[model samples]
Target: MDAAMFSIGNSSSASDNETVVIASNEDLYSYAERVVAAVICSIICIFGSIGNSLVIIAVLLSRKLHTPPNVFVVSLATADLLTSLFLIWDVVALLSSDGWPLPNAKWLCTMTSFVIFVCIGTSLSNLAAISLNRYILITKPYRTYQRIYSPVNIGLMVIFTWICPNLLSLLLSLTKIVGFGYNRKYFICCHFGQQPEDELLFILSDVLLIFIVLVVVVLSYIFVLKHVRQHFKGKRRREVQGIVMQASTSGNDTERQDRQRSTTAENSISQPDPSGQPIRRRENYKDLQVTKNLLLVVVVFFVCFLPYSFLIIFPRSDSFHLYAILLALMNSCVNPVIYARRHPHFKIVLSAMIKCQYQNIPEPTGIAKRFFSRGINPIL
Candidate 1:
């Protein structure tokens, strides 16, 4: 009987030990998840903040980049900068024992959600504004776009971009029409813990807004493309006419001599401007290139934001939702890359800054140089 009782006690002790081991394993898994999430957020914050800051500084320092359209770019960069800064809180919240660092503070969640919404909304609005600006400038250059997008007007637009989203978000939060709080599953504070009806309403409203903005952007690009095609066709036609005119008149010796002299004069006129200055054609080309770069920005914004937006509409699993949010955050890091690649002036400036070789660079030689020489400091 003593042996049997001892055996029973041993069995009970073993079962308790197994239970403790299982609980420990679960805790370890949770801890690992938090660490991984925190690490990812940290990387995103560092990269995004650096890239966006560089863009803002480059634009400020480069007079050439201070054009009307670039005002929107600056605003976008600011929004992205704020986004990167705000993501630090996400990291902190994730690392906390309760997933939300300030779990007892409801206002922190509300404020965080509000700020995130505003930044994201402003980013999207700025992209849409850029697309519309390009469309008007390219497709309807003869219209009142110049007057409409004057510096003061542009400033107002920028102000509106910042204000409208924030005001709306604040109103929604204050009224309790929508809700925001910590989501334990996603380990982030955002639009969560709402009534089912209210959540649906919020999602639908967000979807509608996104749809409208996307439609505007898409249509603007479509018209811009058509205009560009027509412009090239007309230019080609004029070139062909000039060649035919020269050929037809070439048969008469006297006329050919006169025409040759005229052609020589024209060629001289077409040569690079005095002092290696950019010509009107080169200026126009630079503008077109910048427009293309901005269009790329719009495209990148769309691609990055779409996953999160769709997940909101479709209501995905928690893991998928987390990934979607991460993808959206990555947009802040990518815009600078797009700028560096597409904007020649930006690339030159960035390279100069990186290498600390900001002096005594030769003047730009041709149309290519037009991209680098315009009002941008050649050195430093």
Candidate 2:
């Protein structure tokens, strides 16, 4: 979403009579602005690249982490990594040139714009996919959804995430449906044109797509929350029923009644027999932890990308736009940090990878228990 600034040369006959302009305080301020932008972009590029690379490596190295949902995570990391790499070129260009250095290099602009569009699109799409994956896992924890999210299907989803964006962008670029050029205002190479219709179409399409993604992500999380609440409510009801049954069947067989109550409590928490036609499967703690982590990721994604998405629709001042872009890009690096902080298994694996020491790491206390005790269970 970065725009490259380009200078539009005048072709007017009056240009010959016009006097040259000198650098003023405004010029100094503009220069300082570009310098600051270059520094920030450079830092984001370096850190984002390293952090996403670690996520990819960590997932690949850990055998236990190889799940259907993690496949989407790997896809997400790959997209972010590509974005960080592309931003490196943008950073270099910003530092070296005042305006578009290669005004005539339409092909270069188109190619770069295509790559950036694809990467950003893929990243957003993968995030949506992750949210949907969690929603299905949390709300429909049965053999049916399990089969649906099989390795083959997950692999296809990963492929779709990468290909769909590139194909759509390439189609637009190759057909000249969207113009690519240096936006002098934004000081970055991106989709731009003199045609009002084309510009409107580009802006509308980008905004609409972003809105759709936000909608899907928000709805998925909402459904997950509802499902978790229902699950816990049902579990509580069963526990109460078991207690009543024990109380009624009293005194002489008190020991047996207590044993039955404990059994019922345990069964209430355990997954139902897959062979039996139950409405819901047992709530797996491991799966719940994974869902919780993914939920945090979705929240982070929303928080980080919201401003940038807003700016795209309602671009205000240059400073706001710059900070928005930086915040959005910072999300690329933040995933690894989120993984390290919120996911114990990810932390252990990451630690082992960094230390090159394959020692046993103890699992932390149940995240579900902590969440339930706090009167908030996002996952059962």
Candidate 3:
């Protein structure tokens, strides 16, 4: 998309660009390169589709996964699923041996591009939402977290993540501001607006969107880091002060008192604290672990997505642009590895699905229960 946008928005002569584009398509990706590209896209699409489906299905079926954050995970999976489905068509268009397999179905290709763009945009939005959720959960009061991440609010956020992309893409297309269509430059469907000024504005807007997402994600993690560091620092300081006071008081004690003190210390270490501090510490530990896991998701997301966004600003060779597109598409595939393979309940349930271990599994309620209610249902 960025490649097409750059090629289309360039001030060069259209005819010259077309000649160069057509020549470059044949020259750039040879038969071997094309096959490799196809294999990569196929893997991304197949695994991405299946993995994300498992995530959604796991959440739907497993009562344990019905958390506020998993709502974001499902939303993310939904976006990736649409992306994985569209990518097969995307690669087919770009890698076709014949010029455009469907000569008469240009609109179909355009629609596919639109869906791809929207789904990708939605993925970014969902990531941003997840970052915000993490920030609130880590830094805010328990009641405040509960209030903000309540089911009604989560539903609204899921709605926002999906709706925001659709609206933005529609605005671009309806206004003819960010033209997304066939780019002969790389034999890929991408952007090039009719009006240069409008295209420039669209580019600026896209940059701003990228900037916003970056800011939200970066700042959220930064704040979480600060909070965690300060919390542990204060805790260590208090422990040090307590030790100092204890030593000062014990300095006047006899050898028998010292022996008794050592015994008391061992006993205290062995016994669990009756105070709520241990429980609070445990909660903090759990939150920190969760934050780290989601941080992995965010890191993978940016690694997959940033190159494409960078290429948009600094337009590169056809090969680089294609590489960027592939990397961006891969963002969809990598999330499920984080969610399904790494997430606790998600791993268990998805592993069960893989092993066909439904017999011992407690009957899940809602969708899975209904779907599996009648043996060999017609929907199967």
Candidate 4:
């Protein structure tokens, strides 16, 4: 974001009092802050728009990227894409010289608030689903994995990710209840902190629920990593030291894992499946890479969403409002980078598409291996 400063365009008369001048100076500083925020949002919007679109296009163009996990990636990219597209309204609200909100845009702003809320929720939901998928892949038997992640089931999960969030957001918005309003102070949508309900509702419905979901995500990944660890116990480490940090519920537990992992790192490279074990270790490693990438996404999600959720639960200085909004916007922008740099196959497909070399694109890799593998398995 350019550090370019901004000043209100209105000019003052020479006869204005000293108090009026001082007030104008303060107003100028506040407006300047908003301008900085708007600039940062503009940058995020540009990257998110282009990057997320590329993800979708890459998946569509090269079906090789299609898998149960990429299904979530594409779903997430779609949510982030909506976020990038709709977030412009907030930017406009910040930069506009007119009053906080033009009355004419009320319904539009409400809809914008609704969309942003849904996208945030959808993104979290998809991350949780991804974590559960990883949990099953690592811990459960192949037959169990196939039964749970069948095409019909994957379709159901994706549908739940989108439809559930939309329904919840719509229900909240229509009721004119908490977490949805036209923010007057910032002249933006996504009006949180307006309707504070009771404590249980606050915990179950808002920040506490978000906190629980995050903990669940972290714990699920920890379990998957731990299961994979049993497979690699006692292997000689000939590679450079790569970190696979682990978190635990207790401080002592965390320190123990850190000490244990200090000397070893899980290799994400493809390797053969264990002898007599049917689950493909090569694809399992790919799944691990995808999980690692998404775990980072979840961490980012925690950082971005927590403050805003806290603000909703416990309101403080209004100054942090715009900053919180901007932080939330960053989540939409970071995923594409994480996927391109971290995922195994995404970068290859994405690079070819970006270079405009269509012929170089790999052949379409169909759905998740078991979702549509050879020699038909019963759907049930």
Candidate 5:
């Protein structure tokens, strides 16, 4: 192997008769850390697999959650689950041994790396689509249901997200564009000796994917807040107008009644108020506060996935190790917490799922029906 081509590890070359192996980075703390990572990864894989499975089940079973956003979430959960599955092996293998045990099957490492890349990329892009969908829903809510959330658009988004990254990864893998060239008896593992072009492609894709997702998330939330503000303002104006109309109608009736019974007008005027406008306003205020809490949930989702993007773009950077660990573990750690915090409905559904006591399943519609039925219109 040319030292200049791949500078990651300092493994001295071996003669043709000798077997090549990279020297292991072993230390007491490293060993302990590896064990910790493995444990964490295992926990994440277990919970993530269960939680995402439950999510998919709940969506399938519940008619009420048959919305575009929920569909997107289902896709997201699948991506996360797949990522956790692919990543957990590396964690376990690392803790058990310093190198991949199956060096004979070099393509396994390559395929594993490719799968990881695809999952993470698809997950990030799906998230971006979700954010954009939310933004459209809030900003142009009236037309949202008909246009943006339509089966065709959602299908296209899914296909776009899934195909692009895999294609890129496939090209890189086929040409050995990212890893060391064919002559180099380089070890094929999660961490590979990458070329500059390979590094640039990987980093660029990671950065662009993350940047766009974050931008969508941030801008979507901002617009959602603004939309919520406007919504409340319009509602408040309506309430005020309603109050004025009620007061006017009541005053007109009172005047007419006074004309008929002048002697008892003072007594009628002393009657207490019947309508509870104050109570209604308080309830509306409470709902507004609840919406704010929901916004916090959305924020949590973005924050939890943020580190994974950093890891992808700066794979060689110092932060990669810690962030990759977090990314692997976060799929199971974040969603239930976010849902419990933001949406009471999700909790109820989740609880039902846990109890194995589900309600009557809703008839699947749109993309979901298409998904489960496997019938695709040729035009699409």
Candidate 6:
């Protein structure tokens, strides 16, 4: 892991002043700025690595978290981990120097740029897969369990997400088109070139990819919210009806007693009241609500990814520096926080991981085991 970190760190600062970025000529001042950037990057990379590493470990060790969605989450964390260690670390190193001091080679620079870009793309792709998964589960229930939990299907989706972006980045890198003109003033590594068309292609591909993912994510949440609201609303009504029925029954019983005491001349046998009607409506409603709440995972995906979309696509000379970096870095920190917030079980799991007091919880049955009793299900 340390080796991998160093390799990526070495790659990050491979490019310098030749990229045509914001200009700053002061040597000492530049050194201070680069130091600060490295510190920030190190902090983010260290914590991000620890958190994502825990996710992978917990999923592997604890049978409970090894579900289809967690599978994608593992991928997401893996991609982010690579980006922070490799690209962000490089950026930190470059902020001080005008250019890469190490051996400069065409292939090295190209490979470094390619690797860093792919890592970013992979993160977005995994998120998109997650959103699509949630959408299917909520919107199309009959097929959800069958298609979603299949190991074959899940594996393919993961592979597709990982592979597609590198292919896209390869095409972009080959063009030798620099998108954003020199941004030497603030940071380094993977800064776009001056060619508007090249930059536009890169931006379009990124936006298109992210935009699709965000759309699916947002739409999934919207459906989830609608379903939950209707369900809870029905539950509230049923609860009220139940109370009214109890009151009415008590009143009837009292009246019957009063009649019997007042006029014993006509004794009447009483029959048991019919069984209370089944609360099928309420049960269905509750199911919908629970399903919707689960879809919050998709919401997290959108929130983590949105800033990068807006910042990258719309480059501005007057852009805010800290804000841009924050938006990018937020993607690194958001996942663990979201998992902790939304999944109560995950909080306990994450805490256990942090304290190094991991317990052996029996693996929850796989999704397929729960729903598919006898036969294999196909998902294409």
Candidate with best TM-score? 3
* Each candidate's clash count: 0, 8, 0, 1, 0, 12
Quantify all predictions' global Cα lDDT against the true fold: 0.68, 0.66, 0.71, 0.67, 0.55, 0.55
lDDT of 2 by residue, 318-340 (tens): 34765676677777777888887
TM-score for candidate 1, residues paired by index: 0.78
| Estimated TM-score for each candidate | 0.78, 0.80, 0.82, 0.74, 0.71, 0.70
Per-residue lDDT for 144-233 in model 1, tens only? 677889889999999998998888777766655555655544556666424344656667656666778899999998977776666565
What ranges in model 5 sit over 4 Å off? 1-24, 27-29, 174-177, 180-193, 196-198, 244-250, 254-298, 305-324, 359-380
Root-mean-square deviation (CA) per prediction = 11.8, 8.8, 5.5, 13.1, 9.6, 11.1
Clashing pairs in 5: none
Candidate 4 Cα errors over 4 Å, as ranges: 1-29, 98-101, 179-181, 193-204, 234-279, 365-380
Estimate the lDDT of model 1.
0.68
Which candidate number has the best lDDT?
Answer: 3
Error of 1 at 262 (Å): 6.3
- Cand. 3 Cα-lDDT: 0.71
Better of 2 and 6 by TM-score: 2
The clash number for model 5 is 0
Q: Write the per-residue lDDT of candidate 3 for residues 1-380, one digit (tens) a residue.
A: 33333455454647666566567677767767767777788899899998888788777777877778888889889989988887777677767874567888877777777888888788789889988888877666567789998888898999988898889888877776776666665566655554545645765655677778889999999987876665565555555655665677775658755775676555433323322212133244556777788889988988887777777665444478777888888888898788656666676777766666643334465666666675422122
How many backbone overlaps does candidate 1 show? Answer: 0
Model 1 steric clash pairs: none
